[model samples]
Target: MATLQDYRNERLRKLAALRELGVDPYPAHAERTHTCAEVVEKFDELIGQTVSVAGRIVSIRSFGKLAFIKLRDASGDVQLYLQKDDVAGLDASRGVLGMKQLKLLDTGDFVQATGEMVVTKTGEKSVGVHELRLLTKSLRPMPEKLDNKEERFRRRYVDMNVNPEVRQRFIRRSKFWQATRDYLNQHGFTEVNVPVLEHTTGGADANPFVTHMDALDDQQFYLRISHELPLKRLIGAGFEKVYDLGPRFRNENYSDEHLPEHIAMEWYAAYWDWRQGMRFMENMYKDVLQKTFGTLHFRLGEFEVDMSGKWDVWDYAEVIAQHYGIDVYHTTIDEVAAKLKEHSLEVEKTDSIPRGIDKLWKNIRKSVAGPVWLVNTPKFISPLSKANPDNPQSVERFQPIIAGSELGNGFSELNDPIDQLNRFVEQQRMRDAGDDEAMMLDIDYVEMLEYGMPPACGWGWSERVFWIFEGVTAREGVPFPQLRHEIDEVTKAIYSEAELQ
Candidate 1:
């Protein structure tokens, strides 16, 4: 890390270098322009046109008397093949530019160039430089090579120079959101913005980020865990289709697949069932993938998942029973506990048999191969879902598992006021038993249900969907992840002395 003093000294050197050239380091602007894309798009036609552009100086190849300094600007990078004869307009004849022309130059320097686009005999489209300037200087070194893996993530600017694939992923990410907006618009799903600060948080298990509310003085507000509550209010107001795609907070552990904050694409459809939820998601996911990647088959890890295919389905209970050699539906609580113990599965069932069953099922779920619907969950486990008519003990819900992880969960929502109340009571009991992740009493939501919310199937999925689809961990999909940056040694030293006092 560069200290403030280091930056100041580097700036001084840069100022001195620019003064030696008799040019301003920070010019107001470059006069006329063309982007890297425009040059490439109209290459032969743009051959004699002098166009100005600016970007980080990533590479500079020097010949004896002439310098082939590669200047890259936005929309992409192109080499500025600078000849000794044509270096007059942008810089003076002496100082650091001349020294850099003479000695080795590092990577992080920003430069501007005015040149004509021309292709070399090597078939490389490069800028034939008529004028060149060092817009800024870099005291520290950049990636030795553009594609250097050691610097790929730490110094992303260098990675952008060499890795076309990184550019492709971000481009595709933009396209993915655009397709989502397009698809939802066509389907009558209206985009919405909801409040981020909440008095009471629900709708998901993850903990929330805490912050003080100035208006309320000592009152603390939480960053929302899920957009479920607010979106539901829109349904109450007669909007059948609503969606929210934005940042969500989760005060939780970090991993390659879990960020404290991430992007979530959540939507609700009124009067839709679990089956309908499954179908809508399948169609939406397939369409989004095709729109972005031009194919429905995305390879996750070592397995290729075909999104366009009929997604395989299996009973949720059956998934567990198959793994542990016991029919969970027919077995007693003691039997299930004994079996899990026998299998050496560490589960705290005595805390709550339902929690124990949940843990056991979660372990069982990981072994599932490919995309399969783990449906018909035990009702006690999923409080918000409607129980199946034939099997009152099980809920009409399905988890869409892809690459052995649940990408989405859906259920026929409990619209029956009595059933919902009973479930809420059950949840309250769990909370009382010290399960903070359990749902709390939402009297207002229950009142909304009492007002006759149509028997709707609700679906909810997290940002992990995009992470898996992109073949990157969830952490990489997000811009600023939760991993800790190292504390400075000076700060540590000061804190240590203060603690002694």
Candidate 2:
């Protein structure tokens, strides 16, 4: 059996042979009149007419004088027929150059073929090659298949090449964000870019990855954990409706659902209350789902959710009472902690009363199977949200829950500087008491709030939406997820020798 090194060496010899025969193994330029998919889609009109197509040779079969090749481009794949007689007619100087090139080409090599469309005896549509040129020569052999999850993620380029469905998933991811931007733009929202580095990070309960800025007198900075605070500053600056779709970092434990860095979107609309926001978001969700996935119904895990159907509403306190027999508004920190421990659920030591309550709610949330709105959350858990006029104990917050997970969050903006400052102080106390995930005291943001911003509603959601819809983990959805560095064989051997000594 040929090892990877052996395959590379053989390709190197072929590369040298191609050079000797006046063929560029890696050409600088090539012309292609149509992609593989285009030719196949217009096969009827293109029949008997010669057209140029370029793609990587995904499969090859040779029958002495005749050969068949499977050529695949980004658009799609098509079949190619290579005959020795037709190849000899195209090249006057080297009669057998086409045959020799066919012998030298590997599965991964990219080639351009000028051919007329033809139907084989089995009525298989194919391109009958009269001219062939090598565009890119592959030195290393691509794996027949990549099955291991870690390996697939590590070598995503190979995985995408070998698996068309994997390629389509990322294409759909692009469409997802595009659809979101289009929907927002149509609704009079202007998209803006926000800073990634911040002196203090707030807007979400997540520890941020910190870095030192040498350009700023070696001052420490934190990666923005959410786009909320900065985008709100724009609102304070008189932007009626603003949104940002960008990357955020959170220094947290990795899970099937979470990543350290991911793309997130946050949008705020002035003069819109949480009620109006909920209605707008429902339409936005339906639009984005229809545009990206082309379907409103999805089987997410064991639950089936239909975005086209009317969304049910569930109060946060009611959900907790139904599942854990505890009232979120009346439960104490100690009681919540004891109940979590009693149920053998993991609890963070630094968890404040609100965080403890949230943990209890999450346990119940996992079984919801809802295309529902979880509304009227306790004030303690929603520090940045405006309090309900009727019930000051609860905030006017709404979270869309689908298939047992919170898909997105929205709330009425807390515009009062004094109220915002008080909430910040309480969060600071939590941070001081050892909760690393507590929101930072962003004094500048409070100062902006003092300048008077309009009454508005804001909503935020991450690319985890794509993960849920695609039925894959967070890592699988991302093109290149973070992974631990693997030690080379030489380094491993050195470490082993050191251990023995």
Candidate 3:
């Protein structure tokens, strides 16, 4: 049995042999006339015509005087046919490889083949090679299959090659974000990029990751937890409608639906309240979903959710009262904690009435298979949302419950500077009371409110929406997810001479 090192050494010997033969194993450039997919898809028109295709060699088979190579590019894969008598000779300057030199190539090596589109004796569409050039020489062969979870994440490049479906998933992920931007732009929302770093980060109830900036006298800064504050500042700066989509950081643990670092989008419409935001979001969801997934119906985990029809609205306090038999408005901290323990939810000593009640709400949320709107949230839990005109105890905030999770949050943004300050102060008190996930008091944002921001509705959501609909966990959904730092024993042994720490 050969170890990885043994296989690697064998490839190294082949690499040396190629160099000795005056062939550049890793060429700087290779010309290609069409992708593998095009050659196959346009076979009727391309038949008997010379075409150049470039891709990584997926497989190589030889039968005495004849050889066949399967090449794969981003679009798809195609077969390359070679005849011993007809193939071109090796040309190091042009990076061309003769039929005899095919023995030096491996499955993972990238090559460019210029050939005439033809059908094989077996009637398989393929390119008959006239010339083959080395684009890249792989020292470590890509695994034929990647099934281990940790190894898949650690070497996603290999995983992508071995499992093309993983690559396709990311393609859909890209489409998801693009559709989001398209819908927003089509509806007159100008995208304005905001800063990722903030002097005082206070957008959500999540602790922020802090870093030092040497240029600013080594002052500490927090990575923005949400695009909320700065985007709203743009609203105060007189933008009628604005939005931003980017990565935000939070110092938190990873979960099936949460990542400390994730891509999120937030939008604000100056004259609109939560109701308008809700309707707009529903339409936008339909548009984006249709574009990305080609359908509005999704079987996410245990729930069947449809974004097409009318979404039902559920009052926040009412839902909690029905489920837990406790009024969100009048519930005591002790009562909330008792319910928390009853449901086996986490009950901390620092748990505020708002926090405990939220946990209870989430407990019920898990059972809600909805494109349902949850509205009229308690004022204490919703610091930045406006107090409802009809109910002072509840703010005009809304969240869309889908597939057992809150997919998004929207609010009738609070613009009263005095009211905003009081809420900030209360949140600051929570922070002081050892609830680190509490929002920080950003005085600058309060000042922006003092300067008179118009009545607006704001909405935000993360890539978790994509994860839920795509039916993948947080780590699996992301292209690369953070893992605990570790240098495997084999890696350490391999790099021992480099004196790596």
* Best-performing candidate as measured by lDDT: 3
Model 1 lDDT tens row, 362-475: 676665556788888998778878899878989988888787678877878777878777787788777877776677667787888778776666777766877788889764
Kindly list the per-residue Cα lDDT of model 3 for residues 335-449, writing each as its tens digit: 9999999999998888889888988998898988998999999999999889999999999999999999999999999999999999999889889989999999989999998
User: Which residues of candidate 3, in runs, are more than 4 Å off?
Assistant: none
In order, candidate lDDTs are 0.72, 0.88, 0.92
RMSD of each: 4.5, 3.4, 1.0
Q: Could you tell me which 10 consecutive residues in candidate 3 have the lowest summed lDDT?
A: 492-501
TM agreement with the true structure for every prediction: 0.85, 0.94, 0.99
What local lDDT score does residue 278 receive in model 1, on the 0 to 100 scale? 84
lDDT of 1: 0.72
Q: How should the candidates be ordered by TM-score, best one leading?
A: 3, 2, 1
What tens-digit string does per-residue lDDT give for candidate 2 at 413-469?
Answer: 999999999999999988988888888899999999988999999999999988998
Measured with C-alpha atoms, the lDDT of residue 200 in candidate 1 is 71
Count of clashing pairs, candidate 1 = 1
lDDT of 3 at 134: 92
Native-referenced Cα lDDT, model 2: 0.88
